[model samples]
Target: MHGWLTTPPGPGPHPVVLIIHGGPFAQVTVAVSDETQVLVDAGYAVLACNPRGSAGYGQAHGRVIRRRLGTVDRSDVLDFLAGALADAPKLDAGRLGLMGGSYGGFLAAWLTAHDQRFTAAIVERAFLDPETFLGTSDVGDFFVEEYLGPSRALRNAQSPQELVDRVSTPTLLIHSEQDLRCPLSQAERYYFALKRGGVAAELAIFPGEDHELSRGGTPRHRLQRLELILDWWDRYLPVRPAPHART
Candidate 1:
């Protein structure tokens, strides 16, 4: 339920991006994030939040999302953003972007599907379909069963792909071809569904990379990833020009 918001200089109401962290079980601490810096430099405010399911908040908080992937954790993220916006008048509520990797991407996809507040979203290395994840991912079977239960029906209920039909925001899917933790098929399936449903969507697959591409991929690939993300935001949720700079 805690997070950090980094804003660009001379912000009078800058577009904001809610950046979620991977490992629904991991905690996001205050640190120098290269992506956050990149976004801020491009005139976007970045809000990195650690919700209920995140670690370092005691065992009970982290376990609350067990068998409830998109429930409380989803609410915590939106609620946190609401509170953040209310407190920071310099952040525009209309132009909001969402991006996350892995479990974070799951929540981002889940939220944009149900909530129409986001101007755009980037889903990277997401665990989208629980049923397919059970066999494809290195930890799929245990992770899905443990977090979503073993029932096929229950798993489908929490799967983000099931709700893809409802998404209206333009979305970008970024994935690694060799990701064993969340196979490339996850992004492909969602991309196909999104396009068929008439939503603005694009999928970018990086070769020779895995699930850890964002954290451990080669420097060149990582730079490319950053450029891709920035380009997506620029197209869909562009930063408004400052009043003084307006022609």
Candidate 2:
């Protein structure tokens, strides 16, 4: 796994946000997003990584998660995060949060359920129920069989919905109303489940948008999305006051 860690200047220890890139086969590079700078400016340390299934790490590494999906890829991310925290003294491990879209959102939901370390999560344009996604999404069936095999039980097991009962992380679900790729129902299922289970959760559905809402949605909506994310983090992992400057 490869990644970059960025921390704000003049910080003793800062709350950290793990930014996971979408695309089960894509890689997260330093040039990929300005969101890292956004988080840094907001007084948080950011760690972004390209785990095993990500591209640019040889074909074998990228294909390793094929037909295995949630299991191996999740482990790779968690392991990478552990190593990153160990190496970065400025990151506050206890005040950790996560944000990701699409496939990254799937991982975020899974992590929220399986790992209690995260204090907050932003699951954007996520795929929650594999069976439903396989039926409703544009490319669902193909990717489902390609990543999770043809077994019904296996697909259900890997679905985030299966573990919804266990999730306790304060979560925000952002989805586009017109998205056919992951669909708004994906967010709906998880959001409803979280609320029913007494978990802290919020849902934001953007009008006239699709799966690309984060990347290419309307300017106003995109700004609103960023504000929502920042607000969630501030509420859960509020930044501590910087040390007072000497006179």
Candidate 3:
């Protein structure tokens, strides 16, 4: 229910991208990501939502988000769209986009599967299978125990893998080859499902990098990856009235 919004300069009917930050407990808004500013500068409206589960809002909301996961947070997203965009007359509803990494990615994939409101999505190093996560990720057991309770069945019920077969939006999956936390296989499996479902999906695996790539990396590579994301949005989720000026 709490977040920030950014606008592109000299814009009318600009596209909007919903930025979902990672962490079952981390406050994405406080952690800070250059992508938010960059995307805003690129002439798109940005709605950064720190929903119920986010840490900054307090402990209670965080616990609530963890317990319900998709059920509550998904509705939060829907409400966000209703309240946040209602004031922006230039916002393009048909071109709505979702971008998230790690936990955010899972949410994005979940939204893609549960709803058709989004036209495009960018998922980075997303976790798909909680059962597999317990095997592959170093911190999986901790999160599973901390957030979703101790039940294995409860964990699977919240995982994106369980629902990816239903996703229809065009999605771009990006993960680092060196990502030990989420692993490349995670993205691969989701990408496979997207393709199998006859959905438009593309996977980008960054070599010699880890989960930290999105947070900080060589300037050139960082810009390159960011550009690839923007390009993907432009290609598939272009606004009805394209901005007249683009660098």
Q: Choose the strongest candidate by TM-score.
A: 1
- As for TM-score, the candidate ahead, 2 or 3, is 2
Instruction: Give the number of the best model, judged by lDDT.
Output: 1
By lDDT, the better pick of 1 and 3 is 1
What are the per-residue Cα lDDT tens digits for candidate 3 across 1-247? Answer: 6777777867567789997888867765555557878787777788877777878777788888765688887788778877877877867766788988898998988898888888789999888777777778878778666766688788777888888888889999999988888988899888888899899999988888889887676677677799899899878776444568977
Please, what are the lDDT tens digits per residue for candidate 1 over residues 4-112? 9899999469999999889999988877888999999999999988898899989999999999999998998999999999999999998899999999999999999
Model 1: lowest-lDDT 10 consecutive positions? 238-247
Stronger candidate by TM-score (1 vs 2): 1
Ranking by lDDT: 1, 2, 3
Using TM-score as the measure, name the better of candidate 1 and candidate 3. 1
Residue-wise C-alpha lDDT for candidate 2, range 1-247, written one tens digit per residue: 6888888997558898998888888988768466788889999998888888898988999899887777888887888889988987888888899989999999999999898999899999997888888899999879889888799998887889999999999999999999999989899989999999999999999999998887888999989988988898888888874568999
The C-alpha local distance difference test score for the whole of candidate 1 amounts to: 0.92
TM-score per candidate, chains pooled:
0.96, 0.95, 0.91
Considering summed lDDT, which 10 consecutive residues are worst modelled in model 2? 29-38
What TM-score does prediction 2 earn?
A: 0.95
